[model samples]
Target: MSDPAARLGLGLAAIARPAYITSGRSGDLGDERGVGTLRARTRELLDAGYAAGIRYLDVARSYGRAEEFLAGWLADHPEVDDVEIGSKWGYRYVGGWRMDAATHEIKDHSLQAFTEQYALTHELIGDRLAVYHVHSATVDTGVLDDARVHRAMAHLRDEGIRVGISTSGPAQGDAVRRALEVRVDGEPLFTSFQSTWNPLEPSAGPALAEAADAGARVIVKEVFANGRLAPGGGDGTDGARAAADLAERAGVPLDRLAVAAALARPWARRVLLGPVSVAQLASNVAGAELVLPSGVDDELAALAEPPERYWATRSARSWS
Candidate 1:
């Protein structure tokens, strides 16, 4: 198998914004959420991740100026040349940098959303943007069936940028399968997929495997389940308690165990780690190096919750 570190990507979701839905953010990020503070922090994470051999950097337009922060880092660090950048559109950040905002992001998967966001991303990230994904694509959204959107994505592909989709919710598998059938001029439109697939939400595993078999890049996000699987994190749910016990029995940290399980998946070409601090980043790197013991897989497999229940719980989480 290839070295796990080579397959680990640093995701800017947690660190790019002040308030997020991930657990333990109050402790991880503290009260300093000014634009300058986050910009500096993003630079620190980018530097640390690059030094640790993480080449792929994941971001999104809805991640509160994440593309802008990444662009600034790239400009300052011209010597680092081997980074692969992947970003998502379809969601617009509406938090206004305030934690009390009723809405943090607004999702729009229309051609208008793609056109506007793509222009912004390209303006900031330029040629460094290698893969552009339709953020949070779902079956009900009809983004996969939109011919106008397909043509726009195909144009991007023609310019050498791979078009892809990042799925969310309980229907991620369905969305992934639908994306597979999306063809422009008889050629496959999507060549990469990003989806949440922690031990608690392995519902997308089968469809992701099918995508890999079709020669598409598969990136696993939220492997820590938005901090539910991390150490000292999680609500008092049965799955959370079971995961804690299993991690203890495996003699590894909860987050590391979660990461190892995600990495162990044969279809997971790249597993994204969203760490708020350098210490967390180091721990995540250790997770990539971990080798889980036998039978632990079965224990982890048993921790999965019903997709609807799991997503319902996720939807209720408060952004801090």
Candidate 2:
């Protein structure tokens, strides 16, 4: 295997490593310290990621001003270059910054939602945006089947931007297959893809491999199963212990082993690091340094939970 930390091209920019930063907790509604504190913390994490040699940042319109926070960070660090910014559309943040909203985000895969969210993202990040993806494009969403939405995405690609779809739900493989078949003017409309691939839900593996082989940048998300792979998380008790035992045998931290398994996949061009704190981000970075023994991935696969069961656990998790 090549050095995982070496620069790897994804779309218009070359990500410094196979690991990228994701603003999963940076815009949390549960953090009651107000926007000031949240932005400050997010800025701090971004700075840490940059300093740690991360060159890719993932944000979304539904991540509650994540683009705005990143824009501010960019404004402050005007000299920073080679940093690729990837954001997503198709979901609107409806939480209104309140911790107790009936819902946090709502999904809409129509052309109107894409146009509106594209404008919002452009206003915030402007030309710094690198790759723009459709948020949670599942087979049931029929985003790829919608001609209007597909054409709009192609138009964005024509504007010197790489367009892709981030898939969720159990039918992610089907979504990936559909994206691979989408074309505009004899060219593939999407050049990148993001999908969940963790020990519990490795069902997307074969399709992701096919996407990679078809020349699409395959970015892996939810590798840690949204923190369930972490020690003592409530999602999987027995699996967590098994992970701990495996990590101990490998002489690495449990989280590092979890992330390394994702990195080890042949199709994974980049794995999004959804760290909530600076320490967690550092640990995720260390995942690149891990050199797990043979059969580690197979051992981890034994802990796999049913796809529906895995997603159900993730859905029940608190945003906090």
Candidate 3:
């Protein structure tokens, strides 16, 4: 197998904020979720990931100071300059550092949002930001059709930063296809895409493949279904049970199998690992190295849930 580290990227979604929607976070993060604690943890993960040969790092505005943490890390490690950084706009963190906040984030795809968030992101990430994405873009948001946003994104593209979109919800495929159709001056506005794709939620696969065919970079996120596909998660779900059985037969941990499955996608240019600790990162890295038995991928296909059901389960997960 090719080097797993080369195709892997570390995402700061879970570690940069005190609370997130990922399952098993209560155990993984414990009660020490203060800003300082998570900042330190983020640095530790960054150090470990870099040492392990990961060259891509993902963050976003709604990740609650993720860009700030990453900026500090970059400043402290000026000599380590080979990594590619990607961040997203369109959402502002409103959790207020409280787990019980009424809303964690607010999404706005208006040109004003793009302008404001871009300025904030650039202030923190500077030119090290390689790609800027519209966070959680959906068809209903109408961001794909907003000409003003496209012009701003095209400006960023002209400045050598790749403009992209990250899709969410059950209509991820629809969003991806719509993003692909967006053009600025006869050129495709989006050249990169990040979307949720895992054994239990592979509905976006075809659209992502089409993006790859259009020469866009396709990054896979939520490969473990926000921890549902991880060991001891999704305890009552049939999809989880099927995945667990497959992992046992393959002689790997459930999370490892999940990572392996995401990496198995032919169109996936990079897969983001949202591990909260060094141990989990190591296991996920190991998964990237495993050569699955023949027909394992096909068998895993049976684990997919109806898109609506899969998304409903994800939406119902509590912030921890």
Candidate 4:
């Protein structure tokens, strides 16, 4: 029988590379990397990813000109219309490219934010954009409760762009469940959900599974726990050890193992590979092809912690 990890999906359009996920890591943010070098490296990575079969690219308005960077890349590759572009709204980039800015992004989930970000995204990406998600939707954000925002998202759907939400904080499961219920004209308004789901914070898995069962596409973000799940990090010492053992058994690096663990979930349509460099991307690509042995998922699930503890650690991570 074919390997389950080899299954294809609409999100990334490839099976052997964490769906070959792409994001704006090369953009300015907490990264102190030089702008000239960052831009050039981002462009090179885009070309390399495309050549390596990565179709889905994730960006956001808050990702420090990430949309602009992606726009520039797309302009040079007009022949690559089949690439799936997904971006998040609701947060504005306030860093002004400052590496040490007091605040890098500011979140506002009101309909006004959605309207403005949508227009900007449209202007930058044109027709190649596939999905637009609300950045970091939470229980206190009131975005799920905002009828005006729902209506605006419905209008975007009418315009042929898929709408969704990316959940953050301890209430991510609640966020996804609520997003699934958003409706327009008696139909679901949203059709996708992005959530954090590493071994350390698998609490969101049940909601994501429900989302998949409801026919909504589910994308797994922070599959590495924001680099904690990588080879070396300061968070979750015990869980890191467990991941290392799993990687050793699987004959892959810790980063690849972490990604493969995310892909092992049946509900995952795509796993975002947030590599900051070309070398890291190459390592993460191995995850798409490395299927974990039986029982690994259960073992990883055992490491799951309460949502509060999991999110608290993530909140403390420095942008660097």
TM-score of each: 0.99, 0.90, 0.98, 0.89
Per-residue lDDT tens digits for candidate 3, residues 202-230, read 99999999999999999999999998888
Clashes of each: 0, 0, 0, 1
The lDDT per prediction is 0.93, 0.76, 0.92, 0.74
What residue runs in model 2 are displaced by over 4 Å at the alpha carbon? 1-3, 6-32, 234-236
Residue-pair clash count for candidate 4: 1
214-257, model 4: which lDDT tens digit per residue? Answer: 99998888887766677654254676677777777766788877
TM-score of 3: 0.98
Instruction: Compare candidates 3 and 4 on TM-score and give the better one.
Output: 3
Model 2, poorest ten-residue lDDT window? Answer: 10-19
lDDT of 2 by residue, 1-320 (tens): 25554322112110111112222343422334467866776777788777777777888888876777788889999899778889999988777766567677889999899999999999999988889999999878878888888888888899889899999887889999988998888999988899999887899999999999999998888777766676444243676667778888888877788778888888888888766567777887788878778998789889887878767766766644
Q: How big is the positional error of residue 320 in model 3, measured in Å on the Cα after superposition? A: 0.9
Better of 3 and 4 by lDDT: 3
lDDT-superior candidate, 1 or 3: 1
| Stretches of model 1 off by over 4 angstroms after superposition | none
Write model 1 residue lDDT over 260-302, tens digit each, in one string. 9999999899999999899999998899988889899998999
Indicate the worst ten consecutive residues by lDDT in candidate 1. Answer: 1-10
Tell me, what's the RMSD of every candidate? 0.8, 4.9, 1.1, 5.0
